[model samples]
Target: MKRLNIGLKEVQGVYDGPEGKLWELIMGEQIHIGGFMESMVMAKKAGIKEGQKVLDLCSALGGGLRFLVKNFKVQGFGLDGTKTMFDEAKKRAQAEKVADKIEFKLGNVLDIPWSEGTFDVVWGEDAWCYVTDKDKLVQGAAKVLKKGGTLAFSDWIEGPAGLTEAEAERVNKFMKFPYMESGKGYEAIIKKHGLTLKSSEDLGPHFASCIDLYIRMLSEQLTFDALRIIGDNMEMFKGMGGEMAFMADLARKGKFSRGRFIAVK
Candidate 1:
């Protein structure tokens, strides 16, 4: 398999662009997964509670951390590998007035900074697709989670039949997914780490609808901004658009999906 080369740096840079903010504008407080309430519902179901320590793995700009601290009343520690995103996340946490309750650390997902069984819950948003080693990432989460702790995350997963190498390369290159896994592949990894699978669900509509609406939103509303950014590089924008369209087509065909995994240690 080829590496997607997507990371905190690439994601942060893209998010810094007009398209990035557009996504936030469209996604609103939910980020990219349709709605914040859905994520919160999952968090609540995972037994996240007041004052419990939580780890927001692969946290970018502290979105998930902020939600955990504010809605769930949990103290948060966010970890990300990109220095730029780490700084931005720190600023965001402070801006949200939750910096006191949350700590942003610059680190990789494969290597968590805390000790074994350090947190009550290890939560991730729709961000783990960037990590290369799925098993190691799962094991690391399990290692840092306390006994009875929960490992809850929603990620872009390979659909039931999974992705072919060529298709994987296409999707990964465009979406910045380093690797994607089947739902059962993820289940097996979590089970291998001794975590019990509490629930698993396909979150396809969110992805499919969002991608569809995003393209429409751009075509109808963001044409001016996109032209400004893509000035002199219209071809680059066109190429990316083709890739995005391909992704949307795949989602429509039920060839790719986003899966929400809630597991207990």
Candidate 2:
């Protein structure tokens, strides 16, 4: 698979700009597939007990941590690449009165800043697809976890048969992923990192429904709000709709999917 040469700063700006606003509008505050229900599933599978520390990689806007802390009573530290994201996440934590339960740091996921064995759980959401070095990212997660610490996350990934050339171009051009891994591929990545894989589910069906709902929201419900986020560029909706539909088709066919994994170090 080919990877893009984009830097962390560039990718951060993509999400920090109109693209991120659009995503928030479409995907809600969690910014991942299946939202709160999905997070609940991952947390449960990881056996996330109270008092455990979690390191959330690519924790944009700190939504994942906020959700976990509010529901599970975990201490969460979020590490993201951009100051813009770090600041926004911090602000949201404060606004939600969960600031004491969460913190945000600025750094690339591939080159995380924390010391080894610093956390009980290494968590991520849909954000890892933006990283160029998937192996290094997984290795970094392994590096930060305590002995037998869990790794739980959901990521947008290549599906069962993977993406065709044209499909890859369509997705990459719209989603800005440098590269993606499959669920089966990630099982091997976790195994290579010496983490025991508990379960791996291709949550493509769930994501397909989410995308379908978003398309319906954009086309039928949130049309005006969606337009405003794109700076009122009405024509941009055409391209956006095309991309959404193309991705939805891929999801239904299993070429693009939501891959969820739970593992232990």
Q: Which one wins on TM-score? A: 2
Off by over 4 Å in 1: 1-30, 229-232
lDDT of 1 by residue, 151-265 (tens): 9988887776556789888888777667787788899999999999999888776778878887886668766666675564678767766877888877776678888888988
Worst 10 residues of 2 by lDDT: 1-10
Which candidate's lDDT is highest?
A: 2
- Estimate the TM-score for candidate 1: 0.89
Alpha-carbon deviation at 148 in model 1, angstroms: 0.5
lDDT of candidate 2 over 1-265, digit per residue (tens)? 6665666767877877888888888888898877898889889988998999999999988889998998999999999987777898999999989998897888888888899999999999999988888899999999999998999988999989689877886787688887788888899999999999999988888888899999998999988998888889988988999899999999999899988899989
After the best TM-score superposition of candidate 2, give how far the Cα of residue 221 lies from its true spot, in angstroms.
Answer: 1.0
Locate the minimum summed-lDDT window of 10 residues in model 1. Answer: 21-30
- State how far residue 196 of model 2 sits from its true place (Å): 0.8
Predicted structure 2, TM vs. truth: 0.97
